[model samples]
Target: MAKKKALTNVELCKGCRLCVGACPVGAIEALMQVNKKGYEIIRVDEDKCIGCGNCYTMCPDYVFSIEEV
Candidate 1:
């Protein structure tokens, strides 16, 4: 079976930090950097992520994508 991973679209992020807290494995974190819209973006640690889709569900901005790896 193929493995799965979570991907983030920084441009669509709104600095809400919802995904950061929603991550069950603590795979998501907020960066000091900001996007073009000036919203703080988040990064997912692929090594730590479990592809549970929690971040995708919690985000109001639709910033997350789950894909096979």
Candidate 2:
């Protein structure tokens, strides 16, 4: 199987928790620091992520990018 990954662009995130709720594997978490856009951004735990793209699909702000590696 091809390795997959999820990338989060903090700048575009709007502190929405939809992606966190949508993630099936529970791979995402909110960090303490806010981004330049003044929103708390999410961090993807690549080790736990299955690259399912749930985050990408659910995010209103288009904060997530997924691809095969």
Candidate 3:
């Protein structure tokens, strides 16, 4: 069986940081970089993510997508 991971859509992110706090494993982190919309984006550590979908459920911008790796 393949492992699952979370992917991020940088363009859709509004830098709300809800997902950051919602992540159970601290896999998500805020970057100094900003998207085209001038909102700060987040990066996901695929190795640390457990596919719990916490970030997906918490984010209002729908930034996270889960897939098998």
Candidate 4:
């Protein structure tokens, strides 16, 4: 089976951190860098992500997009 992955839109994200809390595999982390909007962005650790969609489901701003790779 193909591996599952998550893509984040830093500019669209609201930095709510719901995705970070919802992830069962702890695949997401807050990056030190901020986007042009000045909101802290998150990234998925591909090695750890299971793409369970928890992050996608929890994000209120629709920042995450998931796919199989």
Candidate 5:
């Protein structure tokens, strides 16, 4: 098994879709739905993340990060 990071802000996310495209492993998916403020959100697949931090850099909502545990 490989080390995996935790992603959040499913509802608060702005859904820029950068993270989805930024994922080198092609692990991210952009969903179509409004948040509390009517902004789009992103969902990540745990099985696909390679802890590459590509999504973390492209995200404006601060939704993804790696835990060094």
Candidate 6:
């Protein structure tokens, strides 16, 4: 299998909430409050994510990415 790039780096996020709408699986969830950049950080809910890479494309900050199987 190929290695997968984990969707991390909430610090770099701007909390535009663009990725949330793009994810079909609803795997991404808003974290505690907001980051230093004033954007609501998100985390991948492994069970819901299908590795569709939808959020990956929507994220302008390149916050999201696909991972290996």
Top lDDT prediction, candidate number: 3
lDDT of each: 0.92, 0.89, 0.93, 0.87, 0.75, 0.76
* Superior candidate under TM-score, 4 versus 6: 4
Q: Tell how far residue 48 is off in model 2, in angstroms.
A: 0.3
Off by over 4 Å in 6: 1-6
Quote the positional error of residue 21 for candidate 3 in Å: 0.5
> Which prediction has the highest TM-score against the true structure?
1
Which run of 10 residues does model 4 get worst, by summed lDDT? 7-16
Model 3's TM-score against the true structure: 0.94
Clashes of 1: 0
Candidate 6 collision pairs = 4-67, 4-68
Please state the error at residue 50 of candidate 5 in Å. 0.9
Report the C-alpha lDDT of model 1 over 4-69, residue by residue, as the tens digit. Answer: 889989999999998888888999999999999998899999999989899989989989989998
Off by over 4 Å in 4: none
TM-score, per-candidate, Cα-based: 0.95, 0.92, 0.94, 0.90, 0.78, 0.77
Clashes per candidate (backbone, < 3 Å): 0, 0, 0, 0, 0, 2
User: Which candidate, 5 or 6, would have the higher lDDT against the true structure?
Assistant: 6
**TM accuracy, model 4:** 0.90
Of the two candidates 4 and 5, the one with more favorable TM-score, higher being better, is 4
Candidate 1: stretches off by over 4 Å:
none
Residue 56 error, candidate 4, Å? 0.4
For model 5, the stretches where C-alpha displacement exceeds 4 angstroms are none
